[model samples]
Target: MDQMMETKKHNTNKGQKLNVQPLRTQTDIETAKFFLSKNKMGKRDLLLFLFGINTGLRASDIVVRKVGEFRNTKKPYIVEEKTHKRRKLNLSNLAEQIDEYIADKSDDDWLFPSYKDRSKHLTVNGVYRMFEVLGKQMGRDDLGTHTMRKTFGYHYYKRTHDIATLMEIFNHSSQQITKRYIGITEDEIDNSLDHFSIGI
Candidate 1:
């Protein structure tokens, strides 16, 4: 799965998916705070999880978000780095955490700033490596930064059956490709059948 996402070559590009798989589970979200806190990092599980799972922005776009950009008194949407388009998405957990992180912060700046350098942006590869080590420590090796996108499309389509919405977010060409992106398969259908009885 790590091999699928080719290196992000262009610093200026947005939504250029390397097609790598996501390495997330509900546990990753649940225990993420405790882990980061132990490392003396401020906990933003909600932000990380929402960024990972909700918006289909690549990690490059995800990490650069400023707290002011999302939960400010001034805006409903922010400009995306890769696409440079005005992007808007719901803010259930995202808004809440952005509020918490920025409430006491001096600058109210970059949402996911680098550990060593607060003013500098955090790299996508950095977030990827952090989560990679976290996943390994937890004995869960099947996850990655892209896991959020995978889960977002998976659950969104699961609840709404709205492939078009996902297609637009992921910028895919078709619904079929979107389904594949979410990794839905016949096995999910086969397993679900045990709970339902089709009228014959």
Candidate 2:
């Protein structure tokens, strides 16, 4: 059986929830990028990976994007599918790459077109399956569509240590939820306990 199926079996036997975690380390992130660049849909997969980690957009929103939305725009506007909130994406970090990726494409083309039908966008489940293979290659079972968004949150928080800003970015109600969502709380707990002693 495949790693994904095996992971499901293991979770079922252990009666534990299957949690999708972020790529917490830079090395792991680089590894993911390397592997994604070698996938069958190398360029598209790499662009999607960069887009997700950079924008923190959900898989649904990212998949539905059109080349026109980002073309010649430094701050592309979008209304999130899940939140229905309109916001502008700061594409300064991705402008050069996006320009190159979309240079040959028309404005109406889906940013992440389906392999079978270029007219249609790739599905969220398709993104999940792609990440599943990436996770298996990375020796991790806890990775899915949310991993990209969470990876963005994790690294951003580590750099800025600004939970309030991250909460706003995620549209989360509380800082605690944002911390836990990005595994920050869990990481802190693990780090604190790693050096704890009871005078034994």
Candidate 3:
């Protein structure tokens, strides 16, 4: 019955267009963290949320990670599920927190374990539902699991202004797609038109 319901929910969302956007401001990001920390699986969920935004990894990749992969390591690596590309994550910022989280756990333990089954990892659908509820709490109808990846791209581009590096990071085909993916193209268009004048 539970599996059936999960399948139904997945099917309902499978073909729908994703209109989600990144948490475009620091306040929005912080608020998301705050709300995630107060959730039922507060610490685990918050850590998952942090890992997502911090590493720009997809939920599928993030949820399947094991504690040994990250513990005592400043550079945890993975082969991206979608692209099948090997990427080494620079986790210097998260090293301490990750170590603390996994301190008592076995090396084989899932980083984000299922709430119902400790031996199993959290599913992607589970993460989707978590972000869905988080979106509602934050008054953002356009939030989803993808928001973390997009948020990472958005802020990285903002700080570095190096689209080429980000493009390689995301493995995107072109700069336009990368720009649009992170919601900066729209912001640029709006900013250009906001002060446009034809001398008329």
**Best-performing candidate as measured by lDDT:** 2
Looking at candidate 1, what is the lDDT of residue 136?
70
Q: Per-residue CA lDDT of candidate 3, range 85-164, in tens?
A: 99999999988889999999989999999999989999987888888888789877777667888899999999999999
lDDT of 1: 0.63
Q: Over the stretch 91-129, how does candidate 1's per-residue lDDT look in tens digits?
A: 664666567667876556777778789887678777666
Q: How does each model score on lDDT? A: 0.63, 0.86, 0.84
Q: How far is candidate 3 from the true structure (C-alpha RMSD, Å)?
A: 5.1
Runs of candidate 1 with Cα error greater than 4 angstroms are: 1-37, 42-46, 73-75, 106-108, 186-200
Query: How many clashes show up in model 3?
Result: 0
**Candidate 3 segments whose C-alpha is farther than 4 A from its true place:** 1-11, 14-17, 196-200
* Native-referenced Cα lDDT, model 2: 0.86
For model 3, what is the error of residue 136's alpha carbon versus the real structure, in angstroms, after optimal superposition? 0.8
